[model samples]
Target chain A: MSIFSNLGIRGSILGLAAIVTGIGVTRSCDGGGIVTSQHRVDLTFWNGFTGPDGRRMLEIIRDFNRENPDIQVSMQRMDWATYYNKLMVAAMDQRGPQLFVVHASTLPRMYRSGFIENSARLYSGSDPIPSADYDPYVLQQVKFKDQYAGVPLDIHPQGMYTNAEMLRAAGIQQPPADKASFMRALRLLTKKSNSGDASQWAFALTLWRNNFQSLIPQFRGRYLKPNGDADLNNPGNIAALQFLGDLSREKLIPPPENGLGWVGYRQKKVAMVWDGVYMLGDLLRLQGLDYVAAPIPQIGPQPGTMADSHVLCIRKGLSEAQRTGAETFIRYLSKNSIRWAAAGQVPARRSVRQTPEFASMPVQSAFARQIPFMMYPPRTPVLFEVTLEIDQAVEKVIRGNADAKTALDLANVNAQRGIDRDRAEQKIAPAGGIQP
Target chain B: MQRTGFLFLAPYAVSFAIFVILPIVVSFVLSFMRFDLTAQSSAGFVGFDNYREALQDNYFWSAVKATLLFALMIVPGLLVIGLSMALGMNAMARGQAAVRALVFLPGMLNIAVTGILWQWFFNGEFGLFNFALKHFGGQGQPWLSDKAFAMPSIVLMSVWWTVGGTAIILLTALQQIPGMYFEAAALDGASTTRMFRYITLPLLKPVMSFVVVTTSIAGFQMFGQAFMLTRGGPELSTRGVAQYIYETAFNSYRMGYGAAMSWLLFALISVFGIFQIRMMRRPA
Candidate 1:
């Protein structure tokens, strides 16, 4: 009888342990992860629309959830910096979201990291997003080593935004047509000893990675050689740098110290600046400022522009039913991304791009003109590192801290080493193996 | 005696062995291997190649230089100011508790918020630093735009936020110095500086060593301020080992390389940590 009672106690302890394990497993599955049941499809959707855009996204997700309660879609919104970090961690752990958003430039890195699903079957055979419905350039941006997978969501291209009153005061009747015209425009608009002398400057450029890369193409210089080495040391690149350096040095534009591009333009201290549709919300809120958007004037023999986009992808680990749910949810979002366009993005779907709504938005439409000529940095696994290297080089050059050639040379050396390191890393995967 | 000692140590031994010792050993060994961060995994024995490459790489050395520069800037400054505050607090002054809390408040604030606040404060156009300069009938110099100013800005921000914790530690050490010691110094007709030098400095060495080692370790681990404020820029002037490690691990997904950096940084910190340990055990 005593032995029976001891056996009963051991059995009860084992049952409690099992119960604890069940709860642990439930927490991962009930909301943010793969569903246990084949009958109930749970979807995890991630994006970086944490701005005012997030509210609209939440509303859309709410509508979707209300209509299709069977397929529960959990909208995970993180900030831009942390969004990618979380996705990469989830992918590394082999328990990622069913669907997520990433920049077009970042897609290559994600693909290489095995954070993205490579199989065509996941989204190809009868998936709601047909390949033909996307703009070719936008579609091309999300391809992984020539393997197209990410459903392109939006196009965010760099364009010239001007303060109309400032431009008119400079006696410029029209926006500049070419590099020379642009230079003259800059010279005319920029007034140093003017009324707001110490406080204001004119014709500010948002000099950073996006705008830096955009300027390269305008100088008739390539950002990268066909062999994938940086081409910033070329003569065209030199001339372009000199012109920009001259602008800041000669007092035709604000020095690196005056980092008031968007704000100065909005407040009417500056005449012109270049940025993406992301800044449209800032402009829309500005009052009493007569502003207009225009296609950036040709900088070189080739008319090149900066266009970045966000690509939606799936995490590596999930059941077959979960993958299907994720794909369906991506298709649903892509189909209904027009609401997203109203918030600032140009819808990635071609049909949506051709609609009256897209045509009506002046800034978005002007930004869209350069779609065929748009370029991003090399879509490699090391692209993000390369961008950092470029930023270092650009800062040195812009601050007059280092010459353009020396800075570019240093950048090239660093980029090459990064590429080599990346190759070495890819050659050595850790542990035995992780499941898909 | 043996049995009682074992009983007292068993739980701690088990925990230390599991959490600390195991991870340290595994990671140390793993540092000499190569691995990818992904669902599909395979690891290769890399020997001392990761360390060799890190030594040879300019970026790594640049990171090292930046870290050392940061350590040099923060460590002594933190100690001097912290101990000074502690001395002030050790006196039975009015509002001592309130002053301690006020001094300690910055350390409790989030690093991200601190960076943003400082960024605005240092902004050339609308920043408070420039605003104050204009008030003095002076020109606004770029506080964070110039590479020279960038490092100083980050260091200043870090100093403001962290000195409080260090002060608290020093204050406790001051309290423990004993009223009898001070009275004895008074009897000897020793000046205030002499008392601090002879009595206070020697007794405080233990806690001083503790403060130095922990702060040194934290100095190398600086990331959020650089990441948030200048992004290690104006031109990579402010990037440190922790930021580089993070970029490698998460941004690049080169987990093996990142691990290699971690162990390398561990060795770097340990060398300093051991020195502090020796200093504490010294004849003084």
Candidate 2:
């Protein structure tokens, strides 16, 4: 109060504004001043790798920082569940990091919102990681409109994790590769109590969304029409859901519950579980458990499995030097993706996958064998809502609460409504034109 | 003197204005606008469109139903358990302070820790509860997964986690009741039951009303327990309004719609609070 009296009210307001402006100015100039004085560019990177993979990523970042004296990339990590919300809020405030990681399926929403930088420029020029190096299917997921939105780092596809000891006990030498053998193995391995309760199951549906999505495509079901309409109620998808329902009805699989499926598999109460390569580290930590990774047994007509990638993206509207530095870091990560794969991932780059070291990782190599047929969920701005609807549908069917046709039909309507709302909010025309 | 008083209040006043009042005002304004974070350019005045959409939204209704169900389950249980625990502790002749501390311990745990601990207990297979059941030759109940059990299971965990705080408040209120009143009643040859009915219950009425209203409000705003336990699963049976609003605002980025629903929930809580206060204030 005495200070305010001395300076006067207007003078105090001006002083406060000046202080704020001074702080802002120093923050804005810090990067440039350091770059000009020491010839070093500082880049901020953010990602949701808050697991075993995070340690691996931290190691890589440290190595990059040590090797590249001219560039400093500081990394921040958070859990994936809340990561997108924080990233979006920061982006809206124009405080987004220069480099970030996003799942390939999430790119559409970010791209549509104009949050991500169009990375087509990185594809050209000297020492570029060529587009040919990535699997075309995985690379295509990062493409939005006519521009590439990000670079794929690694593919994490869901594969069948089998209890090898349980299979051997059932007198089966090899894991099932197709529908008939798979059913036979299930029948042999499943144990029932006198009261008709399943004491042990042959398979437990872990991550039901991925399991259903993988099976639907193998059954020749299209998740979306070419024109971007939901095709969830199609015959092929119905058949897929029916098959999953039958498994529950027959007591071959237990009802999907929290931590039950994975815990059951670990305790040898279940024989097989379809989960992602990210779980390999957790499985490996368990002693005296013999496990093997194989392609999800072919349940339908063709070989297919659900896959997602962790892609590296840049925020829009960076200075030219900043862009260059971010690009260089992305290229370094891409080239060194083999080390990323060591954290239980399939390297996105074909050259990295071909390396003998990658082949030596049995689980990763087994999952990699299905790279050619891996199917990602439909790329849509409203994919989150779509996924929730699909998850609900699958849960209902697997729980024997609703018949497949009814659940799929209801989910189809709900998903279409979400898509329509998204289109209306974004002022986007219906699908024969540019996707919303 | 006034200047010194203002100086003393300045820190709290400034923070309250910035963090609490400002957000309420902003969200009030945002409720009328189409404030989709994903499409910033599309934000504009929509004049009750968001509210209308919430009225038509089935999930909104379901969330409301779930929240009300949770409130019904939790509020009565909290009041009964809290009062009983407080009375029991007050009647203790020895180790009163230690018993009170033991009762209050769970309330000190963070919600996340509480949720995880209870989640381990409620896991259908390989959980402490199920393991105990197997040991006793009983079949394990689907604690978190089934539609019928999910909300009740969450309520059980929440009661364990939060009852301590409520009981402590009631205990303080119990201790504040003068010994003179009970002595006077004893001189009148009143039985223990009659004394409790006439003296203790009457004296504790105001505090009981406070606890009931606040507990009901907190129950209506329940999110963490259900979120950590079932994640609104077994077909969205346990998903409360707060969780739905969170998903709408943060997950779906529909700020306007979320704010609209939040105001509706606020209105519902206010109505319930007023009703409870009025009912509790009436002489039985």
Candidate 3:
């Protein structure tokens, strides 16, 4: 300070300022060198392909990462058990993966929840797929409230499996084509002579919901009309219910206690079953099991069969670049859907189905044929509630909980109430929307 | 001494506070809000609304009924099977360990695997169960798909997988009983059944209480069998509360509602659980 008094206070202040500036400049440079201006983007993809399917998806993702160095995409394959959990967390946190795969059947809730984006923008302006290229039913299945909420990937329809050996032994050389033939084939195949006098169905039905829903279209029944309203009381629905009841009553299908359809079919205990394509992998592994896939033989007035689809969709609210990247990946999978077929699903791209490569595959092509006729449940936001009630009601009916009409009637009531209540609640919901 | 005790509990306190207490508090609070999955950060308070909706939900009730039904069928049966097996094994000293391991081995496998394995076993035709029934001249029953039979079938599978665990627990309890009890009963001219009823059962009460409550809790949260085998079908007969909450929170993106349902189940379990706790506190 004595030296500073001679030099003046300003000189000392200048020295202090210079030192502080030098330190700040050095720190800024050190930090900025690493984080300067190179922006890195993360694209997260979430899916529930926790099997060989998951591994295949991983391989594809690995290739994608290898090819693209700038954008890093992280693929998370989760078990179905906690998939929705992961999605919900991501959604609630507003850090959702850029892309995700969802079962088409459950997307209604996702759509209503606003977890998915309307992707029509890509296809609207001169998309490769002519609207006519898609199956009418599937085209319809892809929408929610007139918005193209999802992009279709695969149709995992219910196929009636014929135990070849059992059917042949029953003197049936050909699988049933319709209700009459189905009855005859079943009658000939099922022999209760071993189990009991009372036991009639040599056929067993498992996972009655799948069995019932698939039959809904056959009976000209739908869980609801297209716009999320109850249509259980419709004649088509009734006819389907009657057939199911008749099948149970006539002992054409065993009450669930007996090995249900797949178990019974694999064991060669039952001659027939209606099950999803997902059952193919398990059936293929059954040591002595030999079965053939066929259309769930049109039992009702319409030839339509029931099914659930797996959809590939972009998570809502991604950036333009992320959306573009996601669209690229989605298109890649859609084109290369044959890989998905190995996982026991029917791919959605019409070209995939027509390919000699795909058609030659034993079950994929035959099952794929049913895609055109496959009936998805109505694409209503409240589809889950309606389906759940119908499923429960159907079970009770089959379990003799109620008569076919009465059961369905009650189911109708429950479905409407659920739809109504859900709408009312949705209306009242703080406008932020569904979390996952 | 109190300080030492506090020091000893420090690690547990930190873990419990972080893992259990914090998550519970978060879940409870989240249950009151309208959680938006797509909004990223848009959540607002909607107090008691989720609770009201969940309470009004028929499927929620269906799930509750199903879960209770599962507990009702499985808990008692598991306890009985476990005790019987434990007693049977205890009486056999030669291959006891081997038999014990064999009985307990299924529990070691996952529930999904167990579900699949038993799906085959209880299968109508090729299932070992129906196969045995047929071999024994009994009628084959549709085990997994029949609404009337599906839940019971699941209970049967659950017991098969879990009886081993209960057996192990009860076996530990049985072993803890001094040899003198059995010897005294034998000298007192007690029949095997009488000895079990009077002496063995009375001594096994604590284990029984533990086994019952634990098994019931497990049964109440039953998911794998329903998820893997029936998928809450042959109708929602097998739809347990856990599946419902899981689906609502995750599948439906209805976190608030799911939280509400879970709390409801929590309350239900607490009522049953408190009784078990009280029973276990009895002076033995």
Candidate 4:
């Protein structure tokens, strides 16, 4: 009944292989002579860095191309909003770039797509990129079954962005670092008008998913178990949600429905917000806004924040020269990552972070302090579904539609159903079935 | 002659088979299987499971409800506004073209631009709508974030974005209704309202049926306006079935489920279309 069956799996595979080999042969010849004397390996690098960060990445790639004569790396930038979909399609068609960038949290899904090269290939050279430079926790995110999926480039961790003028007006000289002081500062900064409406807000939930990811771990809980089962309604998660709900209930912050807190902070009305370090570019563009960046305060028994890294990934099934060129370019980028850090991220390489140039960046350095304890979303192929459930539950709790336990309980059930469905589907799937 | 006609139809037929007909057939087959993109090696038949899963899926049902609610708001709004505009333009002795062009301007802009433009208007903190409300001594309304207001806000934007094209189509149909009918009714000393009710309403029934069926179909498939505005937020209250299918197939990589939902939506649209035609075909 199926068309693939009419062609036969082996027949289709042979047809696909012939087409791929034809394309590869033509592409591999697209180098040498016109631009340079030597036979260069032209590597196409794709990434979703279409912001101010894109400019910095362009500069880094240009520098790398100038430095390396035999390997030419051309970069393509796309918006992160639609990047993964495009990447997946390109990979499926076997037209993917030689090298690409994926977020550390997205590594699992991309790995399952079966297009990424193992990390062993990245470290196979005589002068390998040292594994010692990266934090094991960050490294662990890219690992799958004793092999690494990609190389971690930089960590963008959520940190406290505070309006210094508002804090000073409230008689606070330093940023809050713990729960007691954080609450004290919040109360001191909050002002009420005659009608009891909030005149000046103390804090705001900027991005609920990011804020939830940061807070849930501070309360010492997991959204997904080690086996990738839903664990959203844990006691610590409930406590964390209740704490945030109280902030809204007491009017210490506006409810999530009002607007984005980042906008309020930009207008200098909200005193503080926990946001990613990548937001530094937006703040720097604002005129006359006095702000300070610090690590997110420990509000619930521990210090933690959500972090995601840009990982350098090599596409699977490249020629030996292309693979080597990809690894070489990745090594060059890793060594020169301080420039990437300057663009608004914490360099994942410890040696790069320890440099004086990186230390000079107050926000990056402050956010870097949380790298040891930073939380990456659970590595699961069903991550998108799980996150959707968590986002809905958090929104429900913060918007007062349901209590924390009730909302998360519903989310837990929904996410668990998704996991179960995926498992059941996989179990019945025939081995070596045709790829669409 | 037949061979020559076949040659003329060959290009279109070939493309139709490749792009449209083939995909439909493949997806129909895919709906009864497990076709996970991430696990291509494991893809296989699982008869009726995807459909069964969708029937029990809460999110799927919510998506259906959201889409139905959207259709309920938009279809009637388009008909009333479009019919009213056509009637107004028909009565105009001068500046009819100018008024018609003005009514059609918003429809010319792409959905992305319209969505983004209206998103700025609906933003609670600094939106133009909120700014105007505050200037009038009214409190700011959380346009896209309140469950009570979110779908209505989306409907309001949808009306502005699409009513122009609908008005233009109805206006063309209005112009086709000959002046002789009204004149004949006038000879009988019939009142304007009476003539319009008896003649205009009956003549317009076929076009009105066309409008209603097409509008309902488009409304059910709505994705861009809500996606660009609230991202189906305020706890997914505005997320329609199309967006849910997109997320399931592309974002979640569950191709079988997405295809199954797509067939279900196709069935729903077909049912509504047939019901509309049947109801409209009845004698006045």
lDDT of each: 0.76, 0.88, 0.74, 0.87
Docking class of 2: medium
Off by over 4 Å in 2: A1-23, A29-36, A192-199, A257-259, A433-436
Model 4, A1-436: lDDT tens per residue?
8766888999889988999997667654532111233468788889999888989999999999899878888889998878898888887656788889999888877888898889676655687778888898988888887788889999999999999999998899999999999999989888888856577888989888788888877999787765567789999889888888777777778865567599889988799999999999888778998989999999989999899999999887776677778889999998899999988899999999999999999989999999887898867778899999889988987888889899899989988887777676566332322111
Per-residue alpha-carbon lDDT of candidate 1 for residues A1-436, written as tens digits (9 for 90 to 100) = 6654766987878877998888767745543464646577777788888877777778878887777766788888988888888877775666667778888877766776665775455346765467788777677677655466578878887888887777787787777768888888876666656435534455777856666777766767655555554555677666656556666666666777766877778878888888887788777766888888877778777776777787877776566667777777667778888877777777888898888988998888777777777776666666777777778777776777777777777777777767656555555332312111
Docking class of 1: medium
Cα shift from native, residue B15, model 4 (Å): 3.0
Selected candidate, larger lDDT, 1 vs 2: 2
Q: TM-score of predicted model 4?
A: 0.93
Scored by DockQ, the top model is 4
lDDT measured at residue A417 in model 2 versus the true structure, 0 to 100? 91
Alpha carbon deviation, residue A117, candidate 1 (Å): 2.6
Name the weakest run of 10 consecutive residues (lDDT summed) in model 2 chain A: A29-38
| DockQ of model 4, rounded to 2 decimals | 0.69
Task: Write one digit per residue (lDDT tens) for candidate 1, span B156-259.
Answer: 88989899999999998888878898898899899999998899999999899889999999998888888888877767777888888888777766666777
After superposition on all CA atoms, what RMSD does each candidate show versus the true structure? Answer: 4.8, 3.1, 8.6, 6.4
Q: Write the per-residue lDDT of candidate 3 for residues A1-436, one digit (tens) a residue.
A: 4876776789878877998998767534432112222444457788887766676677777777777655566788888767866776665344677778877766766665566778776456644444565676776667765677667877888887777777777788877888788878776766665426423344677667777777777666766655556778787777777778878776667654544466556656667778888777676556877778888888877676778777777776665566766776776677777887877888777777878888777777767767766777655556566766777677777767677888888888987886665555556342322221
Error of 3 at B28 (Å): 2.7
Candidate 4 residue-wise lDDT, B8-30, digit = tens: 99999999999999999999999
What does candidate 1 score in Cα RMSD to the true structure? Answer: 4.8
**What's the ranking of the predictions by lDDT, best on top?**
2, 4, 1, 3
**Candidate 1 error regions (>4 Å):** A1-16, A19-39, A118-128, A144-146, A171-174, A193-198, A229-232, A266-268, A285-290, A316-320, A424-436, B1-23, B38-42, B277-284
User: In terms of docking quality, how is candidate 4 classified?
Assistant: medium
For model 1, what share of native contacts is present?
A: 0.58
